[model samples]
Structure formats: C-alpha cells, structure tokens
Target: MLVWERPEPPDRPVPAPLSRERIVQAAIRLADADGLDAVSLRKVAAELDVGPMRLYGYLATKEELLDLMVDAVHAEIRPTGDGWREVLLSLAETTRRAAHRHEWLADLLGGRPQLGPNTLTGGEAVLAAMGDVDLDVVVPAVSAVAAYVIGAVRREITERRAERESGMDQRQWQVTHGPYLLRLFATGRFPALAAVVHDGPHLDADQTFRTGLDFLLDGIGARISP
Candidate 1:
C-alpha cells in the first residue's frame, strides 16, 4: 500500500507540522548542492532539522521523493502562446534552463516516465498546443522533441562537467585536443572526421544546442502536413 493509504493511529501523538512540499524542497536543495546522489531521506531530514522518521509522514520511499522533485522542477516549464511549434520550443528552452539551475536533473532526464501532476500538466500543454494535428503523429512528434531536448541538455551537462573536472574551459580544451586530432588527421585514417575537425566551427553551448534543436524541429515539421 502507498504511504498515503496508511492511516495515522488514532491514539498516536501528532508529530511536528511537516509537509511533502517541505521535504521535497529540502531534497532539491541537497541535490543542487552535491548532485542527485547526495539526496537521501536522512539527509533531507537533517536539512529540515527533524528526525529521519519524521519524513515518513510525508513520503514513503526515496523514489517517490525523486518523483516529487522532478515534478517540482517541471512546474517551472510554462509554454507561452498557443502555436504548437512555439509551445514546444518554449518547453524545450524551459527544461534546459531548469537543468542549468539543477545540474543533477541531467541524470534524471528521460530516465523515467514522470507521472507527477506538474509533469502531466507540462505534457498537457505540449499536446494541447498540437491542437488538431493527427493523433497518430502527435505523440510521436512530442516524443521526438522531448528526446532531442533531453539528449542535447545531457550532452551539454556532460561536456561542462568534463570541463570542470579537467580545469579547462571549452576553448582551452579545444586548443589542448586540437593539435592531437590534427596529427591524426595527417595520418589520413579518418578523412571525414578530419574534415569536420578542420572545418567545423567550435560552437559554444548555446550555439550547438540551438543548431541541433533547429535541425530536429525542421525534421519533425516535415512529418506535419501544412
């Protein structure tokens, strides 16, 4: 049975006034500071200055707490306008921004089907924007856009994390690696890759994301008639 299904003992003394919101916020704080692995019921309770058992009143399992955290962040995604394309773009950007604020969120992206209320509401906004689009393609289209957003954001986070660990910014990393790649290019083992390394622009995070997103959206648009 779910935690909510369990009833309080009639004679049990009432504990401190804690709520799910408070617990979830504490978990989010822990995650933001030390990454997702840092968040635990015990840690959250400590953060809240309460005993670990006190959290059981608000949440049952760690998975439920994680679900709540994901939903809480989903609440930040507010799609503007009624146009399906615009709404989708807004959703993607909003999600990216949220991930920026909560780097640990990258680990959870697309890892599960978040069924929390706020998550569903954000999804509803995407579908509602689709309007009269063919039902057959609506879900697929939404999935495609979401996949792109999640994948792109995750890549961005991974690269940034690598940069942080290596003590090198993007430009510095490029300069460090570029010479070795050029040497490999001279060997003619990877002509195609050589061409890219030699000719391709070293786009910053925003440029790389927007370029990929535009391409993804354009491909999706081809499937939508008119």
Candidate 2:
C-alpha cells in the first residue's frame, strides 16, 4: 500500500519521534543539494540522527520515499485562472518553474501517475475548471496538455543542466560549434535548416516554451467543442 494510505502511527514521547514528513523532508534536502542519487534510507536516517532500520517503520522502501518527495513537490503547483486555457497555462508554467527549482524533478515528472493528495487536488482543480465536458473529450484534452508540459519541462531542464555543466550559454555553445554546422549547411544538404538557423528568431527558453504551449492550446482548442 502507498504510504499515504497506511495509518499513521501514534505519536511517541521520545525526544524526537520519527514521522513520514520529517523523513521525506530530510530526503528532499539531500536531493535538492546533491541530486536523487545522494538520497537513501540510510542517509535520510543519518540526517535525522537515527539508525536506518528506524526508517522502515515509516517507509517500506526507497521508492516509497521518492513518491512522497515527488508529491511534496507537487504541492507547490497551484492552479489558477478564469478559464480552462488560462488554468492550463498557469498549470504548465508553474509546473515548469517547479521543475526548474527542483532540477531533479525533471527525472521523475510524468514517469508515472501520481495519486498523492496534492496531485489529486491539482487534478481536481483542473477538471473542475474544465467545466462539464464529456470524459472522452476532456480526458484526452487534459492528457495532451500534460504530455506536452512533461516533455517540454524535461527538455528545458536537460538543456539548462547541460549549459551549466559546460559553462556556456546556448549562443556561446552555438558559436563554438558553429564551424562544423556551418560547413554542413554550406554543402546545401540542409537548405531548409540553414535558412531557419540564419533567419529564425532567437527566443530565450521561456519564450520558446510559451510559444510552444500556445501552439498546443490552439491546436487542442480547434478540436474540442465550444
């Protein structure tokens, strides 16, 4: 059973009683600082100054702890806006920002359906804002937006991490690698690509994401009923 579904143990009178929240928070701190690989039951227990075995009473496995951590982050995604599109846009933007804040989130977003309270609450808000559309139509619409958000957020985070590690922004990287690409373009093998690279608008990451999301919403709007 999921940790949330399990009954909470009664509070003990010990100097520092172990709880699921404390354990998950400690693990998140570790992950936020050193990435997910740094987080383990043993390490979390040690962070709390307890033995590893003490954690098993609160969590069954490391996977359960991860689920809790992900859900905890989802709590940060608050949906707002007057209409369905606005609400979805807000959801996408906030989720993207959250993933950026917690870079490790890119590794786990959309990997599975999260049924934690916060996730379910967010979904409830979205669905409520979507009005009374049929499940057949509404489900796909929401799913499409979700898929786009997940893919875009993951790609953005990956690129951001790459830039950070390589010590070069996108323009610098392009300039540094321009020679090889320019040669390929000059060969007339990628005339269409060359034209875009030479003439296309250079949008920052935020602009790119917003434009893509607007395009997605426009496409979905055309397909769904008024």
Candidate 3:
C-alpha cells in the first residue's frame, strides 16, 4: 500500500520545488528500496526534503497513492505494442518482469485487477491481440494467461520475500520444515505435489509461465482448428 497526502502548492512556494512527478518517482525509489510498506507520505516528503502536510495538492489518500503507484508501474511496462499475439506476449513478459523486480507487487496487484486506465488499456491490448479469435477462445485465453501470470508472479514474489525476510534460503527452509509438508503429502492424496516437494525449485516463474501459456495456446489451437 502507498500513503499520499495533498500537496499545498501555494503554501510551499519553493524556488523550483518538487513536482508531483518527482514525488511519485521518489515514492517509487522508496518503494524499490524499502519495500511497499515503507511508502508513506511522510517518508516520501522526507525523501523529497519537504513537510508531510505540503504534499496534499497532488494526491489525497493512501489508496489513491497506491493506485497511482500501480498505474505508474503499469505505465513503465511500455504501452506501445506490436500485433495481437506479440502484444499480449510482450505484455505478459513485461508484467512478469515488473512484478519480479518488485517482489511485493503481485499481492498488491491481485488476480481481479482494478479498472485503472493503464490496467484497462493493458487488458484491451491483450484482448485486441486475439482479435481474430472468437470470444470463446479469446476470453478463456486472456483469462488463462492472466490468471497464470498473476499466480506465478504471486507465488514467486511471496516465496522470495519470505525467504529474504526470514534470512533463510530455500534449502535451509526445506531442511528444517520440508518434513512436515512431506508428511502431509505422504497420505497419497497429493502424489504429484509430493513428487515435486522433494525436487526443490525445479521450475521458477519463467518456465512455468511459458509452459502454461503454451498449454493454453495448444488447447485453444486444438479446439478452434480441429
């Protein structure tokens, strides 16, 4: 979440002071360095060398700041894209990279996305890419890819953040606690999961994204063509 306050442009008459853009950029930097929870208006003001109350002219609330930050990150993904498939693929990859860069982003950006302009435009671009396909495949295709990407990103970010936050890497984590999870899986209801539990992080997000995307495309192709 982000914390934003109004900026009083009239009260703080500075000699070339910080712009809203600058404030947001500062916020982004703060977020990148200290994680999202650190992005308070006071902290942002501190980063910009200004009073906390002086920031009120730009944004109103924490939710507004978060929305702007989300939109800002979305804007960074490059709105311009090529053809439909290329566009969607680029969007997917761009989103994945963006989320990966900010490990706390995925949970903040859940599966059911908000209708911010950037968010809507990004979705429109994806749906437009499958322009030739019928709604059936197109709808499922979009949802599947989106859902898969969100899930992949969420899992990746949370795991890495947890490991980093805990000061323990996966190997030690597995060594200490894998047995309990293993025991739970030993009941035979989760054979596939059990098989992978011992294997470690065999497939990080890149492979998983590609695999799920390919699976969906293949299925769509089969259904539509045959």
Candidate 4:
C-alpha cells in the first residue's frame, strides 16, 4: 500500500463573505458605469476589495459571471397582464425599460441562451401567460415574442447610444440627414423615395417602437386563440 500526505488548502485570510450574487452585482456596476469590457475578474475583485482568486470561488470564469449578470437584470422584468397579448406587451415594455436603464444589457441581449434561475423565471412567466396553447405551438409563440423584444430593444439602444454620442436626437438626425436624402430624390431617379419622404409623418422613437410592437403582436395574435 502506498501512502501520500494530503496537501493543505491555501492559508490566506478569509475573504469578505463572497457570494455569487454579490460578485455578479459588482460586475454589473462596472458594466453599467464603464460598459461590458470593463468587467473582469480582476476589476470585480478590486471593486470588492478582495483578491481575484476569491471571486473564482463564486464564479468559475468571466463567462459565468457575465451569465449571472444577464440573469440578474432579467429578474427585473415583471410581466403582468390578463392574457397572452397583454402579457407579451408588458414583457416587452419591461425588457425595454431595463435595457434603457442598463444600455450594456443590449450588448448581450439574445447573444446567448439564458439558463439561469432568474432568466428561467422570466421565461416561465411568458409560458404561463400563454395559458392553454398547444405545447408544440407554445414555444414557437413565445420565441417569436422574445425575438421581437430583443431585436427591437437592441435597435433602440443602438440608436440611443448613437444619439448620445453624436449630441443629436433621432428627430435631429432626420432633420440633418433628411435634406441630403431629399436632394437625391430631387434628381428624379427615386420618385417613390421622394413621395414617401415628402409625405410621410415624422414618427418619434416611442411611436415607432409602439407601432411596431402592435403590428408584430397583431400578427402573432392571429396564431393564438386570443
């Protein structure tokens, strides 16, 4: 029989009561303030005033930490409504507001499959709202809603960021660029463009988003019972 001595664990002093939630929160703050690139194990540890290795105990890698952060925000989405349409609408609004508050969220929206407990809870809410729909159709219906939410929110966030950085709102952007586009129309090669640009009503971002949502929901409503 061979005998070997067991090695002792590291003898460093105890870390400040670390937890996965706490670690994720710290990372979120960094992301919120400085964007997602600013979040790193080293940076998170520095924010928490502990060694990086301490975070390793809670999250195995940066990807795991990011996943936790994404789910943490998903927990903020609270959908309340009487039926599937209302529920999906509420869900879309909640997700949009969350993304508005945390623009970095747009960076990861729909980038990966969300599998955390909080993310699962949000999905469960969508499923419950779906009521007695056929199981086969339920997932597809939910997925369509989710796709619309993510795609629309991502575009909204991106345009918002561009507006902020350019010091111009969407309306201002159209005003500044609309004339140039109109010039091309004047050349007589694009009568359709000229007609639309000349006659179309200028829509604010909210109107555009809401109208698009209604249109999408109208299509989805056709498939469901109610």
Candidate 2: list runs displaced more than 4 Å: 13-15
- lDDT scores for all predictions? 0.84, 0.88, 0.73, 0.81
Candidate 2 per-residue lDDT over residues 118-167, each given as its tens digit: 99999999999888667787789889888999999889888888988999
Tens-digit lDDT track for model 4 on 126-210?
A: 8898888787777877777778888888888888778889999867988899878978988999998788777987687778778
Give the top-scoring candidate (TM-score). 2
Query: Global lDDT for candidate 1?
Result: 0.84
- Give each model a TM-score: 0.91, 0.94, 0.76, 0.88
What TM-score does candidate 3 reach? 0.76
**Model 3: per-residue lDDT, tens digit, 92-206?**
7888889877655686776345656677777777777666778977777667667777887787788788888899987898789888887889789888888776675777557
> How many clashing residue pairs are found in candidate 3?
8
lDDT of 2: 0.88
Better of 1 and 4 by TM-score: 1
lDDT winner between 1 and 3, please give it.
1
